[model samples]
Target chain A: MAGKAVPNATRRSERSHRAILDAALELVAEVGYPKLTIEAIAARAGVGKQTIYRWWPSKAAVLLDAFVALGERAAQEAEGPGSEAPYAFPDTGDLEADLKFVLRATVDELLSPTYDLPYRALAAEGIVNPEIAAEFVSRVMEPSVQLYVERLRAAQQAGQVAADLDPRVAVELVTGPVTARWLLRTLPLTHAYADAVVEMALRGLSPR
Target chain B: MAGKAVPNATRRSERSHRAILDAALELVAEVGYPKLTIEAIAARAGVGKQTIYRWWPSKAAVLLDAFVALGERAAQEAEGPGSEAPYAFPDTGDLEADLKFVLRATVDELLSPTYDLPYRALAAEGIVNPEIAAEFVSRVMEPSVQLYVERLRAAQQAGQVAADLDPRVAVELVTGPVTARWLLRTLPLTHAYADAVVEMALRGLSPR
Candidate 1:
């Protein structure tokens, strides 16, 4: 009877964990990050505030985990079942085509309503909060950026990219414009814009 | 007697205006944007909250004006007395040299503690508030970006840049990476980093 109770307890804990994360995302979307509270997250998740405190130190931690989980779920769906490495960068022989394909997908993801609100809220919070900013840079940004670095290194090995070009800095030439346009709202982020960015970065802005 | 009284009134109003702008900037730096209030700004400026309300509709308005005023003040100092067009882009006929100069200055300004906190707070606020974002893009971002466009156009005419390129999009290739590195804090923003970005954009990433 005691062994049966332990399995039941584990299942209940897992259910509560999912509920809390979902609630945090939903509340941030509705109220924005400044107004989001652990108390509110608890109320919506139907869990005690103490339960949240026991698991996470602050609202930022909860939100960060929720976002990371969302990304994992997205990757799993995109890769389909039985894929262990869903986050791998596509490395077709053509660097330009590979970059364009990935960037276009990014443009779509950034503009999607499913990811926009919660992500924007957290991003805004990170901007003003140094601790959150450090966490975000390390956990969310560095990992994704590393994918591009790996792809660029592979391209260099193929002699498609300039041998001396730092893959890290070179990656910025392709990724930064899309991000700046999206963040600053200076122009509409489009597939065409992504394609143009890749073309310019590859071909050079100077007259060939 | 009437003329003298009018001049005195104008002087008093100007003093109050400067005071309010200074207070708003200082308070935002200390408390962050989410907690900034008109009442606090009023008290710090030694004026009633009604005075702030009369001049601006909200705290965001006061903060925006304060930032604009700071930029104007900086421009005046940089350009010196009796300069009408202080905001013009530097065009030395060498596109690489000109871009490197301006971007290096920008790196200095971004890393300055005086500009860093308040500017970042406003930028963070703009991320979550569409209304603020639109206003900022128009009032702050667009104007500075247009300077780059004008310089790039000059380069195009001089046969330095590719004539077929769009100045607006091409400008992003130069500016986007620096802005991304600064905002995301993924790497240290430095003069060397800015120089590398300009060099890479000019030379192209593909082998000659």
Candidate 2:
């Protein structure tokens, strides 16, 4: 579906797309994923249902796009201008600091009331819906996970990370704990928690 | 609420409680959480709804107990017989090997279709419902998370883990990754993945 409607997507179409995404997120936060409907999203966006359907096949698809856009925007805003890549991990020759930065940002986002409700709505849907879960893994989650994998590979090449470790699996070692803490939620999420995760991940759990 | 129930739990009451829990699990799996009802549970268990309410305050309470019982049984079976505790981590003075064993079993449980469906149902409920989420963390999740904390502290005293590390947060260093890998299903959950998490967590990601 890439570039299938590029000619159709004039500047006005981009405005409408953002409006629909915003509307979808608003409605999901208000009523949750189970009750969110295409009609409501279109009405709230001041667009017709046909317009929403023309761009995305389902509400879940629209939400997938909405969250991806939201995450990227958050990442870009956090990184500031003149950065090489928005979501890519920084390589100042310090893997621990870089990981903590990204994870702390994640903690902030997860703790934000605005992001929390809608994301949880989508996550609830994803838990039951296989199609949405697959789309999330491939389109949203995997790409983000891959960024860390890329950064870890860079660390390996720089001789900071162990050469024998698989970067993909190693990425999970950090991401897993952070996401688990967020998802399960027995304690308040903080930069301190993120720092600990980074330290334990970098300097082994055994005595340094 | 704990030992007090033993005096009231005649063989008949014990049988009734089991039936209700079973009915709740079956109904949740069959129709999902939103549709599950005490009336339905009562009908399925061949008991009156009053009988259920007499023991548990709500459907959520019944489900929490149901899941707890299920988890304990699984842990007991996995640990073999004569273990000091059902869900407690084994300390053969080898933190890495012991962690891998528990994590591998977790991988097996997460991958099981029976456990997967009901858990997803309850977890989906927990995600949106604040009260249920709190109950889940305090009751279901924390008990198990504490076990890891205990094991980690044991390692710390033995010099197998860092002296300065917080066992509570350190436990997430491993649990976080395993749950994330399970919750976000881009990769297959397996013993190999569990082993990778264990190794990275204990040995650190750096060249050392």
Q: iRMS values in order, in angstroms?
A: 1.1, 1.4
Model 2: share of true interface contacts reproduced: 0.84
lDDT of 2 by residue, B17-67 (tens): 899988988888898776889999999999999999988887878888888
Quote each prediction's TM-score: 0.95, 0.84
What is candidate 1's lDDT per residue for A1-208, written digit by digit as tens? 4779888988999999999999999998888877999999999999999999999999989999998889888888988866665377888899999999999988998899778877777677887787888888887888879999988888889888999998899999999998788877788999999999999999887887
Note the DockQ of each predicted structure: 0.77, 0.66
User: Candidate 1's residue-wise lDDT over B117-167, tens digit each?
Assistant: 777777777887878888878887788888999999988999988999989
Judged by DockQ cut-offs, the docking class of candidate 2 is medium
Candidate 2 per-residue lDDT over residues A44-127, each given as its tens digit: 999999999999998988988898888777767878756544476677778888888888987887889778877776666677
DockQ of 1: 0.77
Give the lowest summed-lDDT range of ten residues in model 1 chain B.
B81-90
